[model samples]
Target: MFWKSQRKYMIFLIKNKSEGEENLINGKMNVAIIGVGYWGKKIATEYSYLSKKDAQINLYAVCDVFDENLEFCKEKLEIPHQTKSLKEIFENDEIDAVHICTPSETHYEICKEALEHGKHVTVEKPMTLNSLEAIKLVDLAYQKKLVLSVGHIFRFDAAIEKAKSLLEQGWFGDVYWMKFTWTALMPPMVGRDIITDLAPHPFDILNFLTNDWPNKVTCVAKAHRKGQQEETAHITCEFPNNLLAHIEVSWLNPERKREVQIMGSERFTKIDCVTQKITGYENEKFFDMPNVRSNTIGDELSYFVNCVRQQTSNQVSVNKNNGLVGANVVKLLELTKKSMINQRTEPVQ
Candidate 1:
């Protein structure tokens, strides 16, 4: 049955390719933003800018359940199509791809539907709630020959990219440990927890810098305002070569900070994720590393559109924010939860 479905999907892709070639030739790809709420609005804004700057992309439509969100798209974004139905977006052959900014829990279902409808997808982080569902989506995209990208937006950050380059060059020699501090003063989200909501960025950033995943994880989390879900948490990840990473995420902290610190034998480097600033301390000397900031969301959207235009298959592994990377981060989140519950270190299996 899987093989049969895969064959039919391939045929569908072939037909779609032929029919869509004219648009491709004209360097035009119609894209949609699903769920233009808080985060989705930001995504929509970037796409709106991209549409005006690049003729290749069209901010074709937006889908949201709320009337106000749709209204925002209509008035603010000037999107051509605005609807409250996913069915309408999926059935529309003009929309070449979808950027899903819906809540994390809804990702798997919507992403699956988009792929089944022969649309490329770029779903936000925590691609799904679990690794199993993430892997299934990965496989589906592979079978359909579609671009399946995750919103690991930090990977597109100039500072993060520069840090990766420096680490690759062994500028931070004999790395000792790393720390990620992501804290904000925000009220508890009803159904969301700190680990799933905030930890994805740190874990994904760790993978981005080290080009590896943690072998073991130990996590401690608690809820202060509400007992339903954790509001504050600390996760310790054990990577290969004795590299340790500590991630601190909290909704209780008054100050907002998004920083990554790396301690190495050569220098201690700190990256201000928001400001795109990198500072290093070496031999009692503090120096600022020059880095030009980038609009991460815009770059990420452009990369996804390029992938769609190239018909980049998940099998080719051209995308940095590919499905497998998202799945790995989800697996880490699951393991972190396990460690928190068991009060013991859990191995990443």
Candidate 2:
């Protein structure tokens, strides 16, 4: 049943590969969100809400295969334009960018089409189901000179950002290891398991904290649910500088939890992403660190808009959520999957 997921697979040609500043005209960027499902609705709402205040950005359109989703967007979001055909979004000359929030498997083609049409794109996590497709999207974006960012929202969190700053400042001197736990009890997301569904968040955080990708991975997983996918998974990533990262994810837990523990030579830290709290352990004492709350999803979307705006004006160095980080995340995940299948450590390619 999970394999027979909703949403039809989209196929598009790689036409109009010409690259220029298509995202910005008269200092405004018009964006369309494809797929108004759970995550897509959130994105659309953010964009629509922001569009009212930000004159430089416009939430131009919304698209989804499900009519119910479209109707909901129309009623609640009051979005100016809505469609079931992604082709309309692509074919529209006014839209300067597109957000691909469909299933993981559909990311490659939709993003490829958006870039091919000279529109910037932001695809949700696990950019693609596999690395090959991930690489293709990355390369296509680079070739087209369009911003193709992946939605790794936690990277914009204030707590994680502060924790990363502390780590970089050597507060966590000579970091030896880190542990991430993301587990909860909820209805299983169709076409997703703990590994593919939940692992990307922490894995991307691991990369963000260290600014490095894991060189190797090993995993053990079990499928407790009716799907072929694992409902619980334990994955370990070996990074350089003797850094080891462990990720534990499951849908079998009784309560919801999101926690990260990092152990270093000088001090250690425990972060609760949900509560926006951090506790530092050092010198036989634990103290809570003050954290400023910020809307991560809003920040990420704003950053994406800024990147598109800058890149359109030929300002190339502006850093936004790029595709390479997302690709690396996909590569590491594929490696872990291989390790699970082989029951041994697998080198990340």
Put down candidate 2 lDDT per residue, 37-146, tens digits, no spaces: 99998998899878988988888889899889999888998888999887899999899889999988898888888888888899999798887788778667765667
Which candidate has the highest lDDT of all? Answer: 1
**Candidate 2 global lDDT:** 0.82
Q: At residue 68, what lDDT does model 1 achieve? A: 97
Query: Which lDDT tens digits does candidate 1 get at residues 1-349?
Result: 1111234534654464422211221268889999998999999999999999998889999999999999999998899899999999999999888999999989999999998888889999989997889978877777667788999999999999999999999999999999999999997779889999999999989998998888889999998886689999999999778999999999999989999999999889999999999999999999999999999999999898887777643233378888878888888898899999999999886
Superposition error at 260 for model 1 (Å): 0.1
User: Each candidate: what lDDT?
Assistant: 0.87, 0.82
Error of 1 at 232 (Å): 0.7
Clash numbers, per candidate: 0, 0
Lowest summed lDDT window (length 10), candidate 2: 1-10
Which number leads on TM-score? Answer: 1
Instruction: Tell me each candidate's TM-score.
Output: 0.92, 0.91
